[model samples]
Target: MAFDYDQYIRGGKLPHIWCPGCTYGIVFKSILRVVDTLKLNRDDIAMVSGIGCASRLPGYVDFNTLHTTHGRALPFATGIKLSKPDKHVLVVSGDGDATAIGGNHFIHACRRNIDITMLVFNNFIYGMTGGQHSPTTPSGHLASTMPYGNVDPSFNIPELAKGAGASFVARGTAYHAAGLDKLISGAVQHKGFSVVEIINACPTTHGRRNKFKSPTDMLLWMKDTFLPAVAFDKLPAEKTAGKFPMGVLFKKEGAPEYCETYYGLVERLKKQREGRA
Candidate 1:
């Protein structure tokens, strides 16, 4: 017997938009693992997404979902978290959508420390609306927007989240299937803002443009580049150049959730209106 994803899968859309060997499907499976491990009710969870290849994830999963404007997933998910306060909200988005176009919301979402889980699929290039130079697109990386090679440095997403007041932050590459499942599960279980940035491979645009002839080659590149916790601590300054590591970059407690603050304001207003009346 085989594990039939049809149990939770939203059928009738027989074909998916993702290219063959694209890593988004793999990431989706990991998310499903988290959803399954928690044994959560589909009615209690909301999967929100913005306009991108990754954004299409919500359409395939059986849950309360929203397909919002580009770069607005964080705010929309924030609204869901603040209003419902008890629902499990997750945002599935791409690097550009999460970090570039939605960078403002991303920053404030972390500052708010809302009880929502954000999974950023970082393939380095903007694959959905064409291969553009996204905020996380590495320095010297080639893209449609940066044909000559990108000059700006890339963002360290998990580290940025930690600095911006996110309660939990973790990095997981597409190659680390089981590792991602564990990290995502832990993040969803956490009570405050959590970000799981998955470094994935874009076989169509990034792969073809970057000159990788096959999918496995891109996976090898990821394997060669990724480092686990404390793996880069011993590396000297120059040796660490252009290197990117992935893992539970940082996490801590004591940050107040945004819903708690919102409810406090609501109660305060109610008492104020009563006194005036």
Candidate 2:
């Protein structure tokens, strides 16, 4: 049976902030599918996002939303989780907001293993604030700020997430909506911190300047770039060694969750205060 997205989407806003044929819509759709499949109460959920075209996700979704300061979605989400541990909290931000300016918060969020799901929209460039190069922009990738192509190396997002102690980490591209939806849905079900990096399309910014003739061409390029986890593994040792494999990059067990730990600390302190009182 096909998923009826009509119930979840805002009908009045038939269109979205993304450019025509952009994969951002596909990524956004996957997220909505996650919420629906999880049977999550949208009213009880809170989504926080930083500044970017991708940041508009919270606004589009009918949830308790917060459009926060640029590069601060993690902190904002952390506070939300700390205050309302029972709520289903999701944080959505672009590559620059998650990896560059908000880098500190991102690592600590992973370190804490808080029960929060983070979505990283990796459009490669800073699409919202102009076509500048973002943290995830690959070396030699052209951008408005780097007409000669970007000189900085890109971070392997899933690898960084796994290394930072995230309980669950996964990667998928916007072009693969069903796969992305399943991965995101799985992330939402996990009890501890989960990070899913969805390589999205910035056709107007990342594509236009990079020589992609149209948005469809850009999406097709994304599809071509993906190597299945098994396919990646089958590649010769040297060939597979450097390429990023998209799947459940890492999953660990027995890690202490942030909310439960913080609450335990507060309880212990309260007991001490009672003794003094």
Candidate 3:
């Protein structure tokens, strides 16, 4: 039986903006699968996204969605998660929106261990506003801004998340759409800040500029390049030089969650004031 993805989409919002062969739809379907599996109420969930191709996702979803300003999704999600701590807040952003313009927020959100799930759709270029060299654009890739190939080193998003103190850090590719359901589900279930980086292909912009044969070719490259975390661990440095590790890369237990700590402080202060009275 085919899962009706249209059920989760906003009514009358059909004909999405993403181009043919773009993997955003695939990644989104996986996320929706998880939402269905968990049986979460739409009212109890909130989705936030910054400006970008992937960020347009919130506008199509049925949840309480906030389409925030450029590179500011995490801060908006932080406020939502803090104020309505009971709600499950999810942040969807592109590579540039999440790691470049919003880099500071990305790191600090992890450092604070806020209870929000951040899903970064990493297509390696700035898709929406024009194909520019993004923070995660591979060194040799060409973009509109980088006609002669990109020189800026790409970021390892999962590693960055781990370094910034995210308790749960995972990587999944659009080529492995089924696997993403599990990864996204796990991220949402985690207690502290969780980052799930989805490596998707942007064929319309990035692919044309970079001379990729087709969107299919780009996706095949991702499937061939990235290795599962367990297999990646066994390979030596030289063999795994440019390989990305799929699956959960890092996880740590027992760090104070940001909203919980803030509320605890408030309770303590309230108790002290009551004692004085």
Whole-model lDDT, model 1: 0.87
TM-score, candidate 2, is 0.92
Worst 10 residues of 3 by lDDT: 204-213
TM-scores vs. true structure, each candidate: 0.92, 0.92, 0.97
Better of 1 and 2 by lDDT: 1
Q: Candidate 1: lDDT of 118? A: 95
Best by lDDT: 3
| Residue-level lDDT tens digits of model 1 in 58-147 | 998889989999999999998788889989999999998998889999989999999999999999889987788788877777888889
Top-down lDDT ranking: 3, 1, 2
Per-model CA lDDT versus the true structure: 0.87, 0.86, 0.92
Off by over 4 Å in 2: 241-243, 268-277
Model 1 stretches astray by more than 4 angstroms: 234-239, 265-277
| Per-residue alpha-carbon lDDT of candidate 2 for residues 32-129, written as tens digits (9 for 90 to 100) | 88888788998889999999888987777778889999999989889889999999999998999999999989989999999999999998999877
Tens-digit per-residue lDDT, 1-277, candidate 3: 9888888899999688999989999998898899999898988999999999989898888999999999999999998999999899999999999999999999999999999999999999988877999999999888889888898998999999999999999999999887899999999999899999999999988988777889999999998888999999999999998787899988887889998999999999999999999
Better of 1 and 3 by TM-score: 3
